[model samples]
Target: MPSVTTPPADSLLQHRAFVAFWFARIASGFGFQMLSVAVGWQIYAVTGRAFDLGLIGLVQFVPSLLLALPAGHVADQFERRRIVLLGQVVEWIAIALLTGMSLAHGIHEVGILLLVCVIGIAKAFEFPALQSMLPALVPAAILPRAMAVSASAGQAAMIMGPALGGFLYVAGPGVVYSVCGALYLVSVALMGRLHYEQAPPKREPATLRTLFAGVHFIRARKDVLGVISLDLFAVLLGGATALLPIFARDILHTGPWGLGLLRAAPAVGALLMSVWLARHSLQQRVGTIMFAAVAGFGVATLVFAVSTTLWLSLAALFALGAFDMVSMVIRGALVQLETPDDMRGRVSAVNAIFINTSNQLGEFESGMLAAWVGAVSATVIGGIGTLAVVGLWMGMFPTLRQRQRLHVEAAAPADTR
Candidate 1:
């Protein structure tokens, strides 16, 4: 193994493969963010139903849940970049279908949702392959900085994409979908430029046991389990993004552009924090910092729930995003560093499921709860639930609470049993 000098934040941009991969993330993330804003606005406009907004998340999540194990296996068994390329192709086709539907102007909600499911399938496979490929792109010493830089790029896209989507939506839905498709094309081109040699995969026979190995690996690693699960429940309860349409149109009485600003607020905060973290890595008390971030996220959610003033709401959202970014950086570094190389795909797949559950299922939960109570009350209750979860987790997982550092030795193959 070659010694990797810990490069300064700007110098990390010089690594060719990492740069290509970073660009790929930015392009894809921007397109997806635009698609999210467009879809939420379009669906709410057509149906005037909050549950339908939740259904969008549910529709996408099912494919990811069903394909999680198979997707991970495919990543481990095949050329990881090829799998990502295929996933992008699938996304392109889905976007094209959506564009055609928007151009036709029939407003088929079910059709739009069906296309979202296809995108979800693409995401299921792509996420693990992309995550597992990262360690191969840069040496271990720079992995945390690389993760921070990659996250910052994604956040930058998130900030721009939603605002751009809102502005483009004024022209028409067709325009937004067309632009999103073009961005995916750019991402495909960048991903094609990435070059890395993966080790030959072990010739393990496919079996039920093999498919579930990732689950077993996570179960055995208590620290990994604790960190991921903490994120899972906290975000599941605290997530307010699903109800932003309600907040913008009904609560704040803002239009589509206002919705875009609300959506971008959190990413703006995350981007600033990500840039800072890229320069100054968190070197000690990693677990404690993550817990504090989650608690702060809950506090911000509570503040946002009650604020009728748009500026106040945006401020609360910015705080929420800033805290969530801290947790994201720490948890991401832990997941990649702690898992073995051969199982990276599987472990990443499991992590994806946890994330998807927190986000998608959380959306579903928020929608249902909002339907039961009002959106404001549901959001407040969620904030309370999030704070409670953090308190419970801190008590339950002492090892995670006391963990002091983010660095780990290089992953070696280990027994699955």
Candidate 2:
């Protein structure tokens, strides 16, 4: 066998395949972020209903919940690049539909919600393929640095996409959707440049046993289950981003531009932290740091919930992102390093389910709660709930709490079983 040498951390950018994949992430991230801002603004502008805002999250959540297992199976069986390309094609078509609706001056709440569901279905299929592709692209020794770089690029796009969306929205929703569609096309071109040779998959007949493999894999590992579940419930309770439109219009007394700034603030903080982590790896006391960071995220949410001043609220959001970034990096590294290659697609699908539940379902939960109580009161209560979850998880998962490093010895296939 030919010898394999690990690439130096600083030299990750020199690899052409990784660089292509990175740009693809940048394009897709920016388009999706911009599309989100446009959809939220358009929906709220037309209906002026908080329930409809929550409905947007619900519509998107349905496809992911329904298709996650099947999608994971497909990723393992097929060429991942083709799966991603097909998803982009679906996304492009959805964007085209939105743009046409915008141009016709017939943008309806139901139409926007339906298109978002279509996009969500496409995302459900694409996520596992994209996530599992990373480990194959870079050597294990530099995986942490590569992940940090990818996240930073994503954060940078998040910061730019919303602000650009807001600026273009002044012209009309048509402009924003048009720009988003163009970006999706650019992403397709970038994705085509990637060259990944997938290993032959283990041959197994379709069965219930094979489908549930990812769940069983996660359940057997206490550390993976602890971190994944911790993030799931914590973010489910603490999510406040779903209410930004209300905050911007009613509480903060700001317009679309202000809403854009509010959305971008968290990414700004995350981007800065990602850059730092890329330079300095979190090699020690990772579990302890992750726990503390989550607790801090809860406190920051509380501060944001009660703040009356814009500057103070922005500061609170920045702090919230900074803390969340630390937890994200640690959890992400653990997920990538601990799973066996053959099971990566399935495992990543499980992770995606946890994340989507926290984000989209959490948005629905926030909206429903905000409608019951006032938005401010709902947020304050959710933050407290997050803190409560942290305390409970720490007590329950002592092994996870005691974990000292991000690195884990690769388990034998039989050991995973």
lDDT measured at residue 332 in model 1 versus the true structure, 0 to 100? 86
TM-score of each: 0.86, 0.86
| TM-score between candidate 2 and the true structure | 0.86
Instruction: Give the poorly placed runs of model 2, Cα more than 4 Å off.
Output: 1-9, 39-55, 97-114, 169-175, 243-260, 367-377, 411-417
lDDT of 1: 0.87
Residues 288-320, candidate 2, lDDT per residue (tens digit)? 988998999999999999988889889989988
Q: Candidate 1: where are CA atoms >4 Å away?
A: 1-6, 36-56, 97-114, 169-175, 245-259, 306-308, 370-377, 411-417
Alpha-carbon shift of residue 411 in model 1 (angstroms): 7.9
